[model samples]
Target: MKVYNTNQIKNFTLLGNTGSGKTTLAEAMLFEGKVIERRGEVENKNTVSDYSDIERENGSSVYATVLYAEINDKKLNFIDPSGSDDFINGVAAALSVTDIGVLVINAQNGIEVGTEIHSRYLEKAKKGAVIVVNQLDHEKASFDKVIEDATERLGKNVTIIQYPLNEGTSFDSFIDVLLMKKYCYAGGKLEISEVPADQKDRAEELRAELIEKAAENDEGLMEIFFDKGSLTEDEMRRGITVGLIQRGIIPVVCVSAKKNYGVGRMMEFFTRVFPSPNDVPPPVDTVSGNPVKCDAASPASAFIFKSAIEQHLGEVNYFKVMSGEITEGMDVVNNKTGNKDRISQLFAVAGKNRTKVPKLTAGDIGQTVKLKSARTGQTLAAPGNNVVFAKIDFPEPKFRTAIKAVNESDEEKLNEALQRLYMEDPTICVEYSKELKQTIISGQGEYHLNIVKWHLDNIFKIAAEYITPKIPYRETITRIAQADYRHKKQSGGAGQFGEVHMVIEPYAEGMPDPAMYKINGKEFKISVRDKEEYDMPWGGKLVYYNSIVGGSIDARFMPAILKGIMEKMEEGPLTGSYARDIRVTVYDGKMHPVDSNEISFRLAGRNAFREAFKNAGPKIMEPIYNVEVWVPADRMGDVMSDLQTRRAVVQGMSSEKGFEKITARVPLAEMNRYSTALSSITGGRAMYSMKFAEYAQVPGDIQTKLIEVFAAEEKDE
Candidate 1:
């Protein structure tokens, strides 16, 4: 593969809501570029991007697809990503590496969930973006509404570059504002013609707006536009490029991918004006804490943004070269882990296949095979450079389920496949619960994990089953009490006996100090809490003073007692939840020289802790999260009302660009499928994100209900 200069490379990600024609547009681009001999439709399961079995079955992209197109002397790297929130993991990862974001909007639907969802990420990425209003040939298509939606939702930066001469079913051509000419699709090829005299007035009006916006970016162009009140085609083209590179303006183009109309023009626009890697900001500090800047002339340094497990290729690490050239057979250091590995083969990916390349230069995206130590978000540089790229912040998994292999024979295979999938998808998380002894796989939503299971069964041939995840509810004490127990045992050897008495009480608002626990002759007192400080129990140990003043209980049995109490704390006495921050003092006790050894005392301590727990009041605690839902202003009232019904506490509301950003705290237990619920309420037009804020006390009734349910489930399992 040949390396392209920064200006010769056009890297962009195709993004938008499902059914927005992103894949279709991508196919048209490929077809027009002649990269593919023929265009494949999504409905036929032959599109280049959504080529996976699941994607074909669903007729939507399930992962990010990489394809290349060399058009007009420019090499374009097209990242076609899935738009569903379930598969947004791929979209987010794609945004991390791309230079431009092309948000496809259905001319009929105007703006949908994906339009709002991906726009936020693009804004955060600080990448230049263009709104592609596609499917103009469809019946009842509303290009005007889409344009209005684009301007309303995307902000004033949006500028029109083309206007449909005829819209909807009549849509056949577009007037190129930059060229002041009409380009019509004739015989599946773009043909330039003079602007229609009747439409020339409209064309000039649109062209004037375009030129004014373009001129706003350059002083010379602004003076020319002001003096002559018009801009030449060449001047407009140069001005658009400057505006795009500076992210000062976002150009819009109308296309009917179904008719393959305007695609060639879109390609021309990208090759001529789209910003390149050198025009975008460089990668900053990665999680490993090293900053890397793009330097085509410097030693090799690249960052892997995505990884895939190919049956024949093993591990393919897709990366973007930020500095100098990286060649096959050259050793590179993983700045993250300080491990060095040789790139045995480097290739440029085209769909599922790869074109082997001798070297990949800076600003170019490529892949290396069989690099075991390399993974997404890791930086690779010439040995010892220690440069790292910026880390991609992955969204938290919104869904979870317990999974188990179909048989013991496939357990290891299942584990291996899941691990590989986890490495490939940062949003997918898998782990085993020791207490439940079951593996739980989690992702953005139910559909997300379903795809994982599908891959595990079909791709890796490991059958598995899933169950609803355990709520992770916890138990705590609400009141104080005391209990005592004695352990006496006699085996075939010497007899053993030990006794313990401890009191259970409420912990302070924070953590319990030494004063919280009191040693007494007839009563024992200790307090446990549910606050952050109490969460740190100093390894579940509390020092007991030798206040006996006369050695009431021998010091030899204290360690055994402390050990037993710690063990009991781990296995909750009430409902098997870990106990927290309570002090146990051995103020008074009895001892037998021969029988009161560590083992006897340990048992005594465990029994005593259980007794105290039974006497004290117990409660349940649920996890709470801070949720920020961004919705249209018109839907704010409905969203807030719905949140109230879910027992959410609305913190406040703020305006964000064009949406209402509402912040609230809600229990995680009540928000398991809030994404789906929010969609239902907003008709799939709202977007939300949540993070674990803090844990709060569950309501008394709900707490009791959860405890009962948990107890029943534990018994059934």
Candidate 2:
């Protein structure tokens, strides 16, 4: 690999809906650049970008692949990202690093879901964009329809830079309107010729439009065009580059990548018209809390934004150099954790292939192997620089499942694999629930988790079985009551004697306030209230209290009394979900200096908490999620009706998918396996996103059923 000055580099990301010919277009560009002997076909699973086994089997890209082509003394870095919606994160990461984005659309399909989503991201990125109408060689392809859709959906700045000379089967040539020449492919070889006499008039008309659009970006060219009504070739070229960088006009090119038609001209357009790195301003940290100007000449500072675990190479972290340079064997500091690390081996990646590089300059993307603590979103910098880069906020997980090793004996391997996957993909979350006794894994969707487990089994050689995860449930008190317990055991040698008196009260609804359970040696007084107001208890010195009475309870045994209450908090008063946000006070108690040991007091406190919870009115709490579902307009009725049945509250609706985006709040319990249900209702065409909303009181009837179910399960366990 060679290092090119930033001014000589042009970066682009290829994005569109599945089957939109992104991979094929990349192959065609490579073929035209003479980088590859022949253009590889996607159907044969030989395309450079879609190189993974899963991608080959599924016939779609699941990761971003990096490759470059040199044309006209300029280096063009092409990032071919996945088009499937399930792997959208890869597309986003690719876009974040590119200087410009070329949105490819299949002429047969027009604007699609992916087109809309990625267009929005590019708009937010504020990068120059071009729309490529591909697959002109297909019998069903319609350039006019695609152009209309692109103009209407994308914007009016889109201008045709080239047009196909023939339609469908006859599409073997193109007219470059900017250059006023014709390039035709004959027997897979490119031939340049004068514009045909038959289409000369039409070609001139489009050429005039292209020239006029370009002139608008340059004052000198604009004056020439206005005064003389004509642009010289030199003036046109200069204006085109300026227009492209300013995005005042976007050049459109026609191509049939499958047949390699017009690929050479496309490469010419990219090298001549696209803005290079130096032409565009560099990235600045926008993390709000701390911002750093990217410095290419300073000590290395890079942020790890992507990670992967290969079969033989333990871990690979993809980072963007924001300042200075990164080289092998240099010690780096993780700003996120303040931990020092050594850069082992740095390499530039092309999908699964690794090409070792001597050093990576600022604005370049490269990977380092085996940094023990570095994870996605972590920023690595030179030893004295304390800059933390802006973090990428990932989407919330939509699907969750409990995973267990199939053999049970491989539990340790399962844990290691899960941890490795978590480091590789921050979007994938893993956890262990002591109550449910299950190891749960969560991801963006079922497809996301399925692919993760697939990689674990095949690549990491760790096989595990996954089941739908359980909903997290909690229990609390609903009313006030008092209870007492005595622990007295007479043994041949010694006796355990401890007494606890306490009052339990219900925590108010819709508030995360703490409850107060007061215990005197003889009786316990508790006050439970909602967390809306700050009504801290006074005159009682305990966990968070102030005044302690004249030794009502001996200080020696106070620890035991509190321990009993703490144990009961873990065992819910109602349905056995851990109780939370409570204050316990030991107002008074008796202690025999000889027999009142910590163990006796601990057992006594535990018994008191259980008795207090039973006396208090206990109830169950349920989890809720904020949901947004995007479905076609025709499916609005079905989605609304389905949400109603699930007892969801519709918050708002917006436009999406040439359809409606419904925002609602629904119970997590109802959405345990909602991905399947939603897919079924929308015929697998709708998409949804969800995140934790807040905990709500379980409905009375449902709460009863939950209690019964939990009680039975507890007994069985």
Best by lDDT: 1
**Cα lDDT for residue 490, candidate 2:** 75
Indicate the worst ten consecutive residues by lDDT in candidate 1. Answer: 525-534
In candidate 2, which residue ranges exceed 4 Å CA deviation?
Answer: 192-251, 285-296, 311-314, 317-319, 326-349, 352-360, 366-387, 490-493, 506-551, 555-559, 581-601
* Candidate 2 clashes between residue pairs 3 or more apart in a chain or in different chains: 478-617, 501-524, 515-582, 521-588, 553-589, 564-605, 564-606
List, residue by residue over 650-689, the lDDT tens digit for candidate 2: 9999984265899999998777767778878886667788
Q: Mind giving the per-residue lDDT tens digits that candidate 1 earns over 1-717?
A: 467876677788998998999899988888877778989999999988887788998888888988778788888888988888888878888888888889898898888878888887888877778888898988878888987888887777788888887787878888887777898875666789988899888887878788888899989999999999888888887788788767778899989988889988898988888877777667765555554556678778888889887766678889888888898899888988898799999888767757788887788888888886889888888986766776777888767678888898888988988898898898998988764467878788767888888898788888899865665555556665566678888778899888776655555444434334433434333232211122434122233333222454576667787778778777675557666545444445667777888898899878887777676666666668898898888999999999998899999999976789999998887786687789888987788888877656688788667668768978999
The lDDT of each candidate is 0.78, 0.74
Per-residue error (Å), model 2, residue 233: 6.5
TM-score for model 2? 0.85
